[model samples]
Target: MPRHPTFTLRPLHAALCILLAGPAGAQTLPDVVVSANRQEQQSFDAPASIHAVGQDAIEAAGPRVNLSESLNRVPGITVLNRQNYAQDLQLSIRGSGARSPFGIRGARLIVDGIPATMPDGQGQASTISLPSAQRIEVLRGPLAQLYGNSAGGVVQVFTADGPERPELRMSVDAGPDGLSRYGLQAAGQSGAVNYVVDVSDFQTDGWRENSAAERQHLNAKLRWDASEQTRVTVVANVFDQPVSGDPVGLTRGQMEDDPRQAVANATLYHAGKDVAQRQLGLVLDHRLGADASVMARVYAGQRDLDNRLSIPLFVQTAPTASGGVVRLDRQYSGVGLRYSRRLPAGDGQVLFSLGLDHERMGEHRQGYINNLGVQGDLKRDEQDSVHSTGVYAQADWAINEDWSALAGLRANRVAFRVKDAFITGDNPDDSGTASFSATNPVLGITRHLSADTNLYANIGRGFETPTFTELAYRADGSGPNLGLGSASSTHAELGLKTRLTEQQRLDVALFNIASRNEIVVASSSGGRTVYANAGRTRRSGVEVTHSAQWTPEWRSLLALSTLKAQFAEAFTSSGGAVVAAGNRIPGILDRTLFAELAWQPRAWAGFTGALELVHRGSMVVNDLNEDRTDAVTLFNLRLGWQQTVGAWTLRETLRVDNLTDRAYVGSVIVNDGNKRYFEPAPGRQWGLGLTATYRF
Candidate 1:
């Protein structure tokens, strides 16, 4: 076994001292984020771990094409790019949603006040509209529990507001591995209406064989001021992924031979997926009185998907076998309303918000036999539906100039129902209904120290329900598992926020979480998926992030995280294999550091350059704690230039990633029973793009 490295911050402390010696001058701080409290307030006043990535950071290297570019710099968060379009990125916060096989779970995703996470705690970012996003806010610790179910943490994306003047922008990008993208956007305001529209198309021959993908996106947002007391906003978007190839995971032997090689089954069965989705949302804000208001939103969407798996032919011919071809047609809708009331008190004021949310999802699920690339006999059919509702009350009170408090309570209930549509010839009735509910609460306190420093602590209870995919099958040959219970946990945090200098700021935090009845993947065979409740987990960690403008033309940023997550009790796998306590959790790195430096010399106007370094520690691959991937470090370089002339502006950038051409595992499929666990990342790649804009 390899020796673990000792924990120390001496290296970072020394670096901070050097940065503090820069030219002393007055500079304004960036805009404070208010999403954490669901209201507009200075970040320093919030008693939580909150961070924001603004428009300048999002477009530093040009157009925002990938979410990882912004997320990897945030503390207490992990966003891994699998480079496989068939699967969404693996995202987790403080060991929350690491075990998910596909899509995002255990976290709330919000876009323009609309819930991207479905009623059953399943989510995907296929329609994020990154190119048109103005900012993203991440909320961690107790404050996140206010979102109800699946509240591991909160990630919210806000659309860019239209400019007062009409403007149009066009851009084209190209990179290695047959990567190409085109984008166009138009924004402006006309009298009482403000509008922004963006469209993009992308295609790539991926880093690995049989991993190519093609996609297109269209997004629009509009707001109208009907009167001084009432306003309405609309948001709509569509995503179409006509081609997304799956390369599948590689075994140890296969990776050793060639890291770029595709799994044999992937090419044999032509495994891949096709998806199309469209959604629309509307929001209204009305003032009832001087100290009261109402905000409400309604949204609806539809999604169609068909995927082909790589199951062996023999497995599908068995009598009690499920098929390898899956199809889903789903329709979903939701409504949310909130009432805000404020009252003046002694030397302070109190703000309270009462909210209600309701959502429903209906899906037509079918399975078919796979004969190479052709579909064969039917295997399973069912109508699956989920209905959920939540009621919540949140408040923020400022007792005086030196103290403040925030508290919230939420009650959530979700019902899952399945209607068996294929019950012929030995296929016994497989219909059932199950419900799960939880009551979550959060409390936080903030102590204002000096003028520019604060200390805070918070604690909360959170819960999560199984996704529809987790309840599709049972291991005891009894069809669907309807008795699965919800998972619950408690989270605690202590943090310090301070402004060290006019141009620098720092945040440090410590957190712990203990969970019970955690759900884990049990077993999978013949395309049937099953899950079971397992051992408890204890996770503790420390996170820090620092940002500074070292000099007039130089800037630096740093983020570091150290985490220890392990099982708290001995358990057994679904295959009857014993798993001991103290096993490190799979799918997360124990430690990570990200550092960046940028130089924009005044000598050369309109020119900027940056260098980034990233490091990730080794991580276990499965429950046995017998296999792990090696640690890896990478370097990236970026350069850009901007100029404005009369009525036109031009910008261009070049980016080089993985400059060392390192070979590493990007992510792991948690607890794969077949022992296939490794997913190799791209070696090296580069991209260059230019944007031209017109103002009228």
Candidate 2:
């Protein structure tokens, strides 16, 4: 269920510092700090739009849940849980990748210091392990493009590190529709080394038919202080999902007839998937001198996946068609080196950072016919590879106490190659190569208006290349659209950060972006999703956010966004109808609102209560804008209690979601040729979770 938005959410800063000193006669709030720029900086002074959500707020709603559970309220971002586990979640920022059918594309994703997003700008957050998360940082706007080969949004999930004292934690959670989760974590520091490890298992029976899922995950991190000036950190993670079912989208008629029923073909093909991933990363940090430093990070990972779709049987007979069953064996790796130096400049200080980043992904893909729950005749086979390399530099000059400037530039190159191994007489070699390159620059200025306020503005360009999947098909009777080029764009944002009162903080921003060669949906049918370049488009939006600590017992947070995304140039149709200029971009809601309130009265020791409200404006379902999802409002309530006994703490939480039990579509499959666009949201769900922690 969703409702029209009541506009909320906004924040931004520039490099160097945007310090809002604490008020007189009041305990000052600690500076909001971030490390996205390879150095510690104050949020009020950074030139980019960034937001950080801490563990308390993260778990206050639901621990170990999808990002959709916690991120809805954050400005500049949207993550929708389709409830179809096999497809994972759909996430976007500023409507950049809102039309993606599955996973995340067009932006970037990171966990700790490892690249969760590949070099090709494609990513998935299924491996985030919310139970182990200490915080999540989102970086948006033009500066995000400095990360290279992306459309300018960065989502970084950081796992909790070891504490000075040994701690052991265990948790159990259960909810309606047979949902269950069990987790364990251990962390401690000893001498020069610190370590943290977490393991969890999750399972959910479908709210709708053919949508059950089970997953097992493990994550661990170790940090060693090699010397006074050197340190080494290692991060490792493993994920396995033996059963993640796909319910597929439902036609409007089917949704009305029986929203809980699976499409006939989905059940007939045993639509589901199995996934396994393993990753390892190491970071070495060393201080060269008081004015210079170096940091290097290297990572490697692998993924194995098998999936079956609801393709029509007749389509499988086409000679060039890839069958309904898909299998992938992928290996990916990367390394990053960055150097930083600070120099004195007149009355101001200058900070400079230089870096190089490189990554590559190799994939072996195959397709076969689905024989009930088994794999059948071979149909497609190929090897796909992607490599990206970049060099970047940034300089921050604190010209004066009240004024500062930051400038950054980066040059990036990405190459894609594919080799068809299943070439036959009729399905001749469908192999080709494509390369994309771009240079992006960023500039921003911040003015300190007062001890606790600042005004900032920034402008930058963003770039993105098509993924192998998007380039795999050519709708014009050709194979692999290798000639398809990259997309480029320019954006600018003006923002303000200030303290309305000693107890309240607020941030607001207005931004606009215009782009060329924007990727758009061409069609989605017969189990093949294709993409093509739209001539041009523009997106503009406003965001506002406020956090207030009212009375010691009550805390409130509100975030809201309003956006207008439209085509700037008319484009001929891929699905037969011309897409006229000025048409609304499908899948991007016009408005969104997220609000929350928490109460922790002093009289009720160890007790807390929270209420959350999420409202989404109606979203157009396809490029043609012929249909739209109904707007609905959802309410969630949570209550929790903590108790201490003999060096141990016990905690319990209960949450009720979608209290109104409203029937609504959670997301859409944009431009589905079959016109099955809606994916129904679950109604009236409740969960109970319990945790125990021991300290030594």
Which candidate's TM-score is highest?
1
Tens-digit lDDT string for candidate 1 (110-212):
9999999999998887668888889888888988988988989999999898899989989888888898889999999999999999999988998888889
Q: What is the lDDT of residue 139 in candidate 1?
A: 87
lDDT of 2 by residue, 1-696 (tens): 234444333332221012222233333344567765658787766667788888877776675768888888789898888988888888989888898888798778988888999888888789888988898888878778778887568898888878899999999999888899999999999999989999999999978899999999999999999999999999999999999888888898998888888888889889988999999999999999998999999999999999898888777658877888989999999999999999998899989999999999999989888877678999888899999999999988888889988899999999999898888888888888889989999898989888889898889998989887788777754357787778999989998988776777788889999999988888886457888888889999988887766667776777878889999988886867888888899988888877788899899899999898888877888877898987777899999999999989999999999888877888988998899888888889898999999999
Over 4 Å off, model 2 = 1-30, 476-479
User: All predictions: root-mean-square deviation over Cα?
Assistant: 2.1, 3.8
Model 2 earns a TM-score of 0.96
C-alpha positional error of residue 38 in candidate 1 after TM-score superposition, expressed in Å:
1.4
Worst 10 residues of 2 by lDDT: 13-22
Task: Candidate 1: list runs displaced more than 4 Å.
Answer: 1-10, 20-23, 61-63, 476-478, 524-529
Q: How many backbone clashes does candidate 1 have?
A: 0
TM-scores of all predicted structures: 0.97, 0.96
